[model samples]
Target: MAMVTFVDETTSGERRDALGLDIAEERLALRELIRRRVLEEAPDGDDTDRAYDRAVEAFGRNGFLVLVGDRQIEELDELVDLGPRTEVVFLRLVPLVGG
Candidate 1:
């Protein structure tokens, strides 16, 4: 298992081994990565389902930018090969006011 670092701009939070994900494979889908992240971070409660759904939606809507070791990922279905010390950053984009 490779060690990966996760950083989120939305919540300004950083997590290591967020979900104990096994990234030793040659490639990994972004969707699965997000799912694991949500599952790992979701709070246990009656509203856990709701929260998980919201998180998925956010990812689908491009609410955040995912970067793996300086490379920006464009699609949730994109496959990524993470390095041993890969750092993934989820940068939340804030919309600007109308001109």
Candidate 2:
């Protein structure tokens, strides 16, 4: 299993540490990765499904960008390879003021 650290960041340069995950597989689909993240955020609760649904919607609407190491993961179905000490960052893009 690999130890993966997750961080939440914004385009405005705000960053914070999120919960880490232990993944048994070296490779996982983007969708599965998102699912795991949601589960971590709200595990085994009634809100879990709702949270996951919201995450999916947010992803489809480009609410956040998932970056694994130096590469960006675009599609939910895409397969991502994780390293033993991988750092995944969820970057939230913000709109410019008065564009």
Candidate 3:
């Protein structure tokens, strides 16, 4: 299994191998990555299903950006090849008009 680092800008949190996903596979889907992230960071005792749904919605609304290394992921179905030292960054996107 490969290890990956996860970084969240929304909560300013960072973790190594947070979800324990099997990076041994040739590729992984963005959806699975988002699901794992939400599952890893969701508050204890909260409904995981709801949290996952919210995360997916946030992705659709451009609430955040998922970057693998320096490359931005644009689709939920996009497949990413994992490396031993891959770093995934989830950056919250702020709406400028709201300010």
Candidate 4:
């Protein structure tokens, strides 16, 4: 079992909010984590597929960053350990170039 704390953060290192998710798996793929997070965050009746697509797109475009503990996750398919108290931060990117 694992307790994952999902945090919404800004590029400037400011945290906005957080929520918790309890999962039975000890490890999960980053893409799956993103999928679950998107589902959890999306409002009722929201288009989850579209939202997930956007999230992945953002990840690829460096629009946001996913950090697990002290390490930053670069690949969507990367495996992540979901420990007893894992903190996963989604840092929304602020464009420094090519606006």
Candidate 5:
């Protein structure tokens, strides 16, 4: 499975200043980055790889998916205020077969 996480904040400049990343560009950039990573991780041309490729592409093109979650909570601001310690994770979701 693959996990990709990001904080949803309005401070585009702050994200750029703190992480040297432009949040305004992140929505697209991050998705592409995730797609590339998935491809790199699963280059064997298998179903899993194909699924991940489609997911990452969708995330990049659409901006959301069942496996991806985005939260805009003011309370979490405290965590970001604390500093880089705050991090988000994105994991791949797959259906379970037999129990």
Candidate 6:
């Protein structure tokens, strides 16, 4: 299993070890990682860096294994069985323009 943590492009160096994930018995799939980032208290300087650190710590702990999968708004409320050996992760992407 794998634990993923988010980091801004600027703070890529300090991202590791900040987010600890336990993956002894499970396998991790990157394609199905899903989650929403909600910032409660915005950091004054380098908010993305702070937010990434917090998000990694919060989501990577508790022996949780990430399983990537496809999800839609309609099936979001249902519990799916991707086999007993796998965990499910659903990530929602926001739209960006004028890159």
lDDT of 5 by residue, 4-95 (tens): 33433322223211122222232333445444445545547566657666765654453332222353222211122112232343332233
**How do the residues 30-71 of candidate 4 rate in per-residue lDDT, one tens digit apiece?**
999999888989999999999999999989998888999889
Tell me, by lDDT, which candidate is best. Answer: 4
Q: After superposition, how far is residue 18 of candidate 3 from its true place, in Å?
A: 7.5
* Candidate maximizing TM-score: 4
Candidate 2 vs candidate 5: which has greater lDDT? 2
All models, RMSD in angstroms? 3.8, 1.5, 3.6, 1.4, 12.8, 11.5
lDDT of 5: 0.37
| Worst 10-residue lDDT window, candidate 4 | 11-20
After TM-score superposition, what is the CA distance of residue 79 in candidate 2 from its true location, in Å?
Answer: 0.8
Model 2 misplaced regions, further than 4 Å: 43-46
List the candidates' TM-scores in order. 0.72, 0.90, 0.78, 0.92, 0.28, 0.24
Task: Give a tens-digit lDDT track for model 6, residues 1-99.
Answer: 333343221112322222323334333223222222223234456566556565455444422233234432223223333333333332322234663
**Where does model 1 exceed 4 Å of error?**
10-26, 46-49
Query: What lDDT does model 2 reach?
Result: 0.88
Give the alpha carbon lDDT tens digit for every residue of 1-99 in model 1.
Answer: 565667766544543334345466657887767766666677775465677677668877878788897688888789878767666777887666682
By lDDT, the better pick of 4 and 6 is: 4
Candidate with the larger lDDT of 2 and 3: 2
For model 6, what is the alpha-carbon lDDT of residue 30? Answer: 32
Q: Among all windows of ten consecutive residues in candidate 1, which has the lowest summed lDDT? A: 11-20
TM-score of 1: 0.72
Structure candidate 4, residue pairs in collision: none
Model 6 Cα RMSD, Å? 11.5
Clashes of 4: 0
Q: What overall lDDT goes with each candidate model?
A: 0.70, 0.88, 0.77, 0.90, 0.37, 0.34
